[model samples]
Target: MLYAILAYHVEEEVASWTPEEDATVMRDLNKVHGRLNELGRLGPAARLGATEGACVLRGPRKGVVTDGPFTESKEQLLGFYILDCADRDAAISAARDLRQVNPSAMYEIRPVKLYLPGVPFPRTEDGVDA
Candidate 1:
């Protein structure tokens, strides 16, 4: 199975939602997640905190610590989902369904790269080191 990392970005400013509204949206999203689970395609999904709640680490020694998001952008990354699908087309289909539910949000789907067990590095299409 091909694994995809789906990144979701909110299109508008972060506004507080009423408890009822929040529950409704959550229910809708969960329903889709349940379907994916039944198909054995859903791996994991999570909604992350706002950028202000994040911390960044950088440098070879991982000694550099920075505040909040690395950069400021119009849309902030709000959540992500890991999906297992038959192929990229299947992943795209799932993304399209998700987009219909969250019409104002942006979703990015990228294949996840994995190294085979006992392999020191990932393989490349040209048979070169990745």
Candidate 2:
């Protein structure tokens, strides 16, 4: 099965949710998650905290260090799901369903590349890496 990542861009200040509302959303999402699980398509899914909670380390010496996201965009990543699907269309269909649960958010569906030892990377129709 092919894998796809479903990422969401959440408004910085709008990512927070009241405890009550959070519980409600979780209940709804769990229903969908259960359906995916039954289909043997769910891989992983989780909600991330604020960008400020992230730490970046770079270089061999790890001299380059940063807090939160590097961009100045108004939206930051809130969470994501990695799903096993048959194709991009299936991934998009899943994402569209997710959007209905979080209409105010934006989602990006990206295919996950898999590299196995001793096997050449898959190539696209145009000769680009798949």
Best by the TM-score measure: 1
Q: With candidate 2 superimposed using the best TM-score fit, by how many Å does residue 57's alpha carbon deviate from the native?
A: 2.4
* Residue pairs in collision within model 2: none
* Candidate 2 lDDT score at position 110: 82
For model 1, the stretches where C-alpha displacement exceeds 4 angstroms are 11-14, 115-130
* Candidate 1: tens digits of C-alpha lDDT, residues 13-44: 33466667657666777788888989888875
Q: Model 2, residue 107: what's the lDDT?
A: 82
TM-score of 1: 0.76
Off by over 4 Å in 2: 11-16, 59-63, 115-130
Per-model TM-score versus the true fold: 0.76, 0.74
> Each model's C-alpha lDDT?
0.69, 0.69
Task: Give the total clashing residue pairs for model 2.
Answer: 0
Tell me how candidate 2 scores on lDDT.
Answer: 0.69
Instruction: Determine the C-alpha RMSD for candidate 1 after optimal superposition of all C-alphas.
Output: 10.3
Candidate 2 per-residue C-alpha lDDT over 27-80 given as tens digits, one digit per residue, 9 for 90 to 100: 777787788889898765656656776877766764787785666656667777
